[model samples]
Target: MISSTPTTVTDRDFATEVLSANQPVLVYFWASWCGPCRLMSPILDKLAAEYGDHLKIVKMEVDPNPESVAVYQVEGVPAFRLFKAGEVVESSEGAISQQKLQSLIAPHLAAPN
Candidate 1:
């Protein structure tokens, strides 16, 4: 069964986990200290569940994953980047509603089987 939980990603395995993923990936860049980041957790969880099979959702803690944070130029928590075929196809930052998050992924998700 596919897991809805967002896989924890770090600079160490970012390339393999996100960049090389078979499906499109939505990378959530968050920091523990950010209140907004905490608020986004459940919304992200929901998205992970709905799109788990068609899209990959991964979380990267900014503090420990400097390489990716820097590479992605994520200066704030709760930033999102959607990647397809090893390229960024869409991106957004800040705390956003579930509907907004869905819009970000909807374009990339494969039609349900």
Candidate 2:
């Protein structure tokens, strides 16, 4: 059995967990039927653990969270929304490689002074 830290978000918690999070949060919008979404899960889990301090990774199933699905204007599965300061600053759709995901979050990591 594998344990993961990425909080599985629901429509009810989206506002507080993703939108109002103090740090950057990566909201992974996916569904059970989406093969690509399944493929990206482990990568996200790994990234979440490694960047836990700087980023918060969460997943919300569109099928069950229709409200949030419509709110985000997500048209595709395996969609990603990067929220900073309560707003979406970056996003991607479809299956994305780990390298691409890393690049997306790398800039948000702390810069040594």
Q: Which number leads on TM-score?
A: 1
The global C-alpha lDDT for each of the candidates, from Candidate 1 onward, is 0.90, 0.86
The per-candidate count of clashes, in order, stands at 0, 0
Residue pairs in collision within model 1: none
Question: Which window of 10 residues has the lowest lDDT sum in candidate 2?
Answer: 1-10
The sequence of per-residue lDDT tens digits that candidate 2 reaches over residues 6-96 is 8998999889888888888889999999999889999988987788767888989999899988988999999999988988888899999
Residue 96 in candidate 1 has what lDDT? 96
List RMSD in Å for every model shown. Answer: 0.9, 3.1
Clashing pairs in 2: none
User: Could you give candidate 1's per-residue lDDT for residues 1-113 as a string of tens digits?
Assistant: 56687999899999999889889999999998999999999998988888888888999999988889989889888899999999999999999999998988898877887
What lDDT does candidate 2 reach at residue 12?
90
For model 1, the stretches where C-alpha displacement exceeds 4 angstroms are none
